[model samples]
Target: MRIRSDGLAARSFDAETVVLDLEKSQYLTLNETGSLLYELLRQERTMDELVDAVVAEYNVDRVIAMRDVEAFVGSLREHGLLTGSDVLA
Candidate 1:
């Protein structure tokens, strides 16, 4: 799977919270954990890497992290914020 970083630029609202702003659109709010995941995605980490990172960083099981990451990616696609040539292939 492909991760899109074009729409997001990292910014800190406070010491604890991180926000992702979509291109010319409103900001997407993320908690500390979500922010960490988002930053990883910015580096174009593969699906497996993201799952591993999430599982390592959070106290969640591998299975749950995989499912949650898939769902989060799907949501990003649905929002028109994510685009990739491979997406249609």
Candidate 2:
């Protein structure tokens, strides 16, 4: 899934990312891996694709990467930051 086009603004600072949810008037911060994933989430991506990216970038195991990606996407969804058919509820 991709980031929502409306009511969300983000900036990257080195390995970190900060997101502002205008609709919710809340701020979210992302760590290094999350920042990378956030950039990829600018475009549509599948769960597998996201996991693959985490694995490739961090050299983490597939299972751990999948788990982390799931959690990250969950956080984004909870904050209404993602928009796409592939986005999980």
Candidate 3:
């Protein structure tokens, strides 16, 4: 599936990512890994692509990378960062 990041004003600082949801009036801060993942999510990507991105950027194991990416996506979904339309095949 592909993820979308609409209605967000995001900025990256060093290894951190900050996003402000104009509609929700909420903001989120992400660490190094999260920042990279967030950047990737701006484009359409499969789950594997997300994992591969983390693995390539960091020296983490494949399993750990996948787990972290999944967790991050889950958090993003839970926070309403990605909407139903943002998710597509």
Best by lDDT: 2
lDDT of each: 0.64, 0.87, 0.78
Which one wins by lDDT: 2 or 3?
2
Best-to-worst order by TM-score is 2, 3, 1
Candidate 2, residues 1-89, lDDT tens digits: the string is 78988988888898899999888899999999989899998888898899888898889999999889999889888888887766433
Q: TM-score winner among the candidates?
A: 2
Total clashing pairs for each candidate: 0, 0, 0
Off by over 4 Å in 2: 87-89
Please give the RMSD to the true structure for each candidate, in Å. Answer: 3.8, 2.2, 2.8
- Can you list the residue pairs that collide in candidate 1? none
Per-residue lDDT tens digits of candidate 1, residues 1-89?
44465666657565334445556666566666666666666555566777788899887998899888777777656655554532311
| TM-score per model over all chains | 0.68, 0.92, 0.84
lDDT of 2 at 82: 83
TM-score, prediction 3: 0.84
- State the displacement of the C-alpha of residue 62, model 2, in Å, after optimal TM-score superposition: 0.2
Residue range with the least summed lDDT across 10 consecutive positions in model 2: 80-89
Task: Extract clashing residue pairs from model 3.
Answer: none
Relative to the true structure, candidate 2 has a C-alpha RMSD (angstroms) of 2.2
TM-score of model number 1? 0.68
